[model samples]
Target: MVKKLISVGSILIPTVLTILIVNFLFDIVPLNIQGLPLVLPFVICPIGAVLGLIGYKMNRDNLARAGMIFNIVLFLFPIAFNIIGTLSGGV
Candidate 1:
């Protein structure tokens, strides 16, 4: 039960954060402080991925696997976004 909850949270938290990050990056949501939005994802995504890993180890569930995969993608998202932005001359 507890493991499942953690697994769900690992999925939810990063998904929400990823949405916010994408919004911020694309200027859909205006944020006054430039660096503020980025800091959380770098810290949180890894934590979420780790939590998912731990949950998967404990319960052998699909939710944990999904969570981990999402977090990994989330972790790479910024780098990819930046690369694309650079190649395109500021996205």
Candidate 2:
């Protein structure tokens, strides 16, 4: 269980957090910081894809399981974010 958790975290944590970090650090829409805006959403896809390939090569079983976990996260996070945004009047 622990290894599975760790494996998922190894890939998902970095991929998702880096997406958020780049957005926030670059001061994307609604952010108060001064910097370049993300004119395109998929601009960061290469980074995530490279990391995903690395994760895939690390261990097939681990990567597969981690991917399932990440998909669940991918499904849930947006709903949660939407709810929060709606409540906060940002929607």
Candidate 3:
């Protein structure tokens, strides 16, 4: 049960971060939080990914796998975006 919760949290944290980032980018709300984009990808996502990996190793199941996948994607997302942006002259 605890392991499953960790997996679920790993998946959820990134999803929420993505939503917050998108909202901030589009100016959908008055998000005055500073350094959120950098913090989410660098600090939060890596932690989530590590937790997910541990959960997956402990459980060896599909939910854990999904959590691992989500965390990895989220963690890599900013780096990938930066590379593409530089290549496309957006950076």
Question: Which candidate gets the maximum TM-score versus the true structure?
Answer: 1
**Tens digit per residue, CA lDDT, model 3, 1-91:** 8988888887888888888878766878876885577467777887887878888888887776787778778788778877887999964
The root-mean-square deviation over C-alpha atoms between each candidate and the true structure, in angstroms, is 2.3, 8.0, 2.0
Per-model TM against the reference: 0.82, 0.38, 0.80
Could you say which candidate leads in lDDT?
1
Candidate order by lDDT, decreasing, is 1, 3, 2
Candidate 1, residues 1-91: lDDT per residue as tens digits?
A: 7988999988997988877777776888687767655667778899999989999999989999999999998888777767987999965
Off by more than 4 A, model 3? 89-91
Q: Which is better, 1 or 3, measured by lDDT? A: 1
Clash totals for all models, in order? 0, 0, 0
lDDT of 1 at 30: 83
lDDT of 1: 0.84
Give me the runs in candidate 1 sitting further than 4 Å from their true place. Answer: 25-30, 33-35
